[model samples]
Target: MTTALTLTTGQDQDGAPVLVAAGEIDMSNAERFTAALSEAITDRREPLVVDLTAVEYLDSAGLAALFHHADRIEVVTGPLLSPLLAVSGLADLTTVRTR
Candidate 1:
């Protein structure tokens, strides 16, 4: 079963786009996350900043979604690391900034 993933959007002081995601991102819900990101970038024409601080887990499907849109999005996460991106070897390919 696909768990519900929470996605929130906001802008920085300079109008930079930001998306805050809080939930598990696995095969079941990867599409939902991708759709949310697609919506965030549609028409707005701004680089996306994804805050994965509250994300507890991530999987290959989630990484694929991010890779598909790697050029348009920047990812930021909290210190506690999850091996999903690292194991997928996308930590360097995408804009994943850890805090």
Candidate 2:
């Protein structure tokens, strides 16, 4: 597919898992995003923090990927994505922090 998305998984200073995403996340790359997210969900108990600060664009397919695993994932967002997260009701399923 297209190289419009990038995903990386690592631990934060506190050892919490973090998934960093960048580039456009739309129908073209949603599957890639979903696969990355699925692989990142290694710990079913602990929350997975997704840093979307670098995500410049997102669409329903991309958002649905998050919703599919919203129960175990937390979101780190910004003005660009916060409103969409809230409007899509994803904010209710998990903690969404604005940055």
Candidate 3:
């Protein structure tokens, strides 16, 4: 079964779309995560910010969803997930800033 996951949407001070994700993101729940992200994507051309500050884990499937939309997304993450994103080459594909 998929582990617990939560996703919330908001806008940044600059009015850019933001997606805040919490909990583990793995194969089982990657589709849900992708759906949340897709739903949050707005018409604005500005890149979407995916805030991964509360995410505890992320697997390949989870990373793939982010990769698929790398051109339109940036990410805010924490130390726990930094290394994984780095080695997965996601950092190169999209912007990733550790918070």
Tell me, by lDDT, which candidate is best.
3
lDDT against the true structure, each candidate: 0.80, 0.90, 0.92
lDDT of 2 by residue, 9-80 (tens): 998898888999988899988998999888888755688999998898889999999999998899998899
Tens-place lDDT digits, model 1, residues 1-99: 444679999887879888888978888888989998888874567678888888888777888888888888888887664355666666777777887
Clashing pairs in 2: none
TM-score of each: 0.81, 0.92, 0.93
* Model with the higher TM-score, candidate 1 or 2: 2
Per-residue lDDT over 54-96 for candidate 3, one digit per residue giving the tens place of the 0 to 100 score: 9998988999999988888999999999999899899999999
User: What is model 3's C-alpha RMSD?
Assistant: 1.5
Relative to the true structure, candidate 2 has a C-alpha RMSD (angstroms) of 2.1
Better of 2 and 3 by TM-score: 3
- The best-first sequence of candidates by TM-score reads 3, 2, 1
lDDT of 2: 0.90
Clash counts for all predictions: 0, 0, 0
Off by over 4 Å in 1: 1-4, 42-45
Worst 10 residues of 2 by lDDT: 1-10
